[model samples]
Target: MATFAEPLRPNVASADVQLPGVRDYEQVDTEIIGTLKPTAGWFGALGVAIAMFLVGAAAWIYQIYWGLGNAGYAPPVMWGVYIITFVFWVGIGHAGTLISAILFLFRAGFRTTIYRCAEAMTVFAVMTAGLFPIIHIGRPWKFFWLIPYPNWRLIWPNFKSPLVWDVFAISTYLTVSSTFLYVGLIPDIAVLRDRETNPLRKRILAILSLGWRNSEPEWRHFMKMYLFLAAFSTPLVLSVHSVVSFDFAMALTPGWHATIFPPYFVAGAIFSGIGMVFTIIIPIRKFFKLQHYVTINHLDAAAKLALFTSMVVGCAYLIEFWVAWYSGVAAEQDYFWNRVFGEWWWAAWIMLTCNMIFPLSLFSQKLRRNPTWLFILSIFINIGMWFERFVIIVPSLSHEFEPWQWGHYVPSWVDMSILVGSFGWFFMWFLLFIKQLPVVAIAEVKEIVPPKLRSHARGHGLDPSGHHLPYGTETPGEFD
Candidate 1:
């Protein structure tokens, strides 16, 4: 392995420089793989995550024992924090596929450093999102009824319900996203396997790596399949969120009925997902000392994307009010009015400020390039996105057409515990993931590194191909 005298440093320049701050193949390996090593902080984080998850699990058990009524189920606002959180997690999961698949297809260079962790976030967020439907249904065990199973009674899920569509959408997203994530990990795991001295660990990695030898045939097959998956997964970025939106747009309720919802939800999902990517990667870059790989240039590019989505989301908000007023439907206009100034006005304003107002700061070039500011902005965006969902779901359900049915919802201790637990659940998986596997893609990182850095002979690096591959060569690409 080729070694550099200096450790990798964060790149503060424009992302126009391809794979900025990365040098030899071994530097990528050394820095990214180093994150897998155990530290006191890692243990401490894991302990906190475990405790949070256990508390959430306990809250869930209590909910199950006491029934769904134990949640903050006000009459008109039957859907509360659980449904809001479900949508939030689903939205959070969107950026991963967008970064990994859509950005890959577009050949975006900035994605090279950050896409691995983003993809992981997608899978875990979806996993966390999946739990809410079962919890909300009040019967966790019989959740299989949502599936199209061939039972003796011949009962099947309602094809008309958007809730049923969610089952298909979330499941398909999870299946494809999980497969894509694991496929990308094979080569990286092979690197870990070859370097392992522990017999048991080596054996486990060997199995996970699926005999990845980086040979010519393997690279050919790998690149072809990767391209295919990227193409296949690209449509999913648009479709999954659109389907989630249908849950609202298809409804007859005053605030819920809107044609703009599909695109509106899609944009919001991307915005939130990117916000989460910043939240996760900034810390990983700082703590794991992976600044060179996940540089300021990369984050600046991401901030730009977030800014673009923020505009789209802000526009959607304006369009919602415009359509309601323009249509002149009393119920529709009333619902819109109540959403902004009624019982949950504070939540609505927070959503507006966080999602629309705060993100405006990213338009400044300096803050876009500053990791600290970007991190702080990303936190606000996530919080705003959460409130965005809360405002959307709760207000609409609470203030429906009939005045007699109106009611205000307040989340119980159970609701709050479960909500907090969901974060714990998400972080627990993410923490375990970073510790066990390479958080950055080794093969993909090598693919994007500048040609000047590709000085090694075939045997000197992770590539099993006979010779060093150039930047543009498709054959024996990462390995050759």
Candidate 2:
């Protein structure tokens, strides 16, 4: 028995050679770049994003110049928007890594184009997410004290603390996520490097590509490295979020303490992350004309994941209620009751509607297939997920055991600005990424689209192949 070699299509070198008018690679490239370039609307969006960022920046500056007193983080509400946004952004980062790393490990073909953008979102969102802890500290300058470094001062971070655990977990997550994102982007960067005519662009891409020459050996090594990174990333996805959940579970707070927090938080993270992906990608696909690559099929698949995770999240919610009542813990029962019928009843209802009811519509295949509906549903899910985080963080902290500390907490302008600004920061990096990188992985797209599908237009006399050939005409033996 003879082993068959993998199919060989055109590499980056052959990509430059045009097949006459059959496919205007230049036009396609132009369209791709054009979609990425900031248009008038993008500029407006950028301005809003920048303004929000500056507002958050100015708030942090004031916090640094003065103290944490400016941010409304009093004794009771010590963990305010900072921790809330931290968890929120961390949750937002979940779907990207899970989709890219885990799905890739399972050889999910739909991830080819979606994963690149999703991974980019993961890295940037995590970066933004990591900032909250630094800003949340009263003395922001002493942020590094969280690290257990050998120092002349003979000071060490408390390893037993959940906050310290968070530092380790988040840092590890950021490092691993960034590594995965950069590794996956190298091949695409090489393609850009080859196509780039400008010296500066070429030089930058070349360095980013790490001297990749697009050789068979290079591609082979790249694949192995990427696979290893993906494998490494999969566990980090589970562990990092689990560690985050521990921050709450290990606490003595009635609603916060629970063994189920890990899986529950992870599911909510993935749920929110998918919502964010859809929110970003839907508009991008339309504006960029990436319909072929980011088709309804991709959206449908994402919707399915979103719906599945939503169900998991819903189950978690139900279990939390059941456990609180069944445990016979008076405080826990009151806390759970207070969550639903208490002052924060509105937040609980919002969570139930967004996480459970809204996503339930996706059971209808038509709703999931419709892009407009998908976008609407995604927005609702995002809002609901945010509410879920807010509900988890605020009510538990606001209404603790002590009657004096059982005061209601409301976000000030500073808190609201910072929260909204985080969205701006996320979108800013994401928009910049779309402009710089090939939003669609061209090589991967070519790999996935069947050889027969490639030449269908040619057979219909719509392509410039001249001869009415069957599929795989231009590259006959190559595809085989």
Candidate 3:
């Protein structure tokens, strides 16, 4: 997601060199660390999230008492709102990994500012997504049975099941993303450890920092480990979501049988996740006064990314329908046609309008750069993407062959409460994260910027990628 940047200048020397946006090294630390303090607004937001979380808890309890019937789960549509919500959150989780690991591997330097919070979102979103499976399983206490482990009873998971693959895929993704976020934060934590005076707080940060010393050896090892982790985790972005898609693709259901499922799901996941990223960062950037850090340029870059992924998803939608009709498969054709013209036709059109038509607005530079427009459109994209999963899951199931067994699923209050609560769970974790930690990566931002900026300096003028920067010219629409 490279933004428009000016052409590079070659005359700058070591101490005078700086990234185009930043001011100085000392100020970078102050600005980033300053974000951790809790304000009244922060607490107010947290309170709402906590309240919603409680509502969800109560809903779960009621569901337990009433059994799965409370969610309107039925035979043909056995996978109801719970499975749909699971896939939605899983898609939302994809943006963090995409922006953090994949963009890093691709060397998109602009990602440094947004990656920290985005990575944190990945961990929390995955946690939220993971819960749906447990919730979907009627026996919550027996959720542990999904794990394949050696035991006295000798029970094991179904090795061939996509559900089993999800356990591994999501667990692996969470572990890697958490480690990546923490590893990237060690230096910043050490900085906070030094900045704070309290004995208890300093000690905990010191432990978490693993004794970072700003030494060449420490940096050398850190870079090595970071690179290795980024490379290793990159493929999981595609694999994890592909496995989730397999939960549908492996089914014999007409709409679920495409070989295109893997890439299609991956594209939609990135699209929804990028939409979510904008939804969070735009306000945070303004409220936290991080304008210089998460610049309009950065937002422009992200909007472009959202547009790109939306197009990919839109193409996948078209291809799915075309293939269904082209194959002359009665069941597949019927399932797709019912989606656009039958009982669930409304959901299909909503998905197409939101995911495909609305995203084209970003092609206008004015709209992409306008924060208010960006925010509103992002919200719509999120809603549209969610409906995409709904239409995909429901229509096929509701209009399956032998209309006698066909049925429509409507979520009960319990289902809606839990669904809303999942969002609260995600936001609550993020709010706690913002209050306790630097929302941006201090060290990575400093890497491209020079140690001193107001003086005539020597060497180190080149970027981390070894390109000499344009010192004075301010050009737009170009990037490394």
C-alpha TM-score for every candidate: 0.91, 0.88, 0.92
Clashes of each: 0, 0, 7
Q: lDDT of all predictions, in order shown?
A: 0.87, 0.79, 0.84
Best by TM-score, which number? 3
Model 3 residue 58 lDDT score? 92
Error of 3 at 17 (Å): 14
Give the range where candidate 2 is weakest over 10 consecutive residues by summed lDDT: 12-21
* Residue lDDT tens for model 2, 317-346: 999999999999888888889999998999
lDDT per residue for candidate 3 within 24-90, as digits (tens), equals: 6677888888888889999999999999998998999988888988888877888878899999998
Candidate 1 lDDT over residue span 1-480, tens digit each: 998674132332232335435656777788777789989998999899889998999999999998999998979888889989999999999999999999888887788889999999999999999999899999999899989989999888899999889899999999999999999999999999998889999999999998999899999999999999999998887888899999988989887888899999999999999999999999999999887777666787799899999999999999999999999999889988888987788999999999999999987877887888988999999999999999999999888889998889999999999998999999999999999999999998888664332334524432443333333322211110
Ranking by lDDT: 1, 3, 2
Off by over 4 Å in 3: 1-21, 453-480
User: Which sections of candidate 1 miss by over 4 Å?
Assistant: 1-17, 451-480
> Between 2 and 3, whose TM-score is larger?
3
Specify the highest-lDDT model's number.
Answer: 1
Candidate with more favorable, higher TM-score: 1 or 3: 3
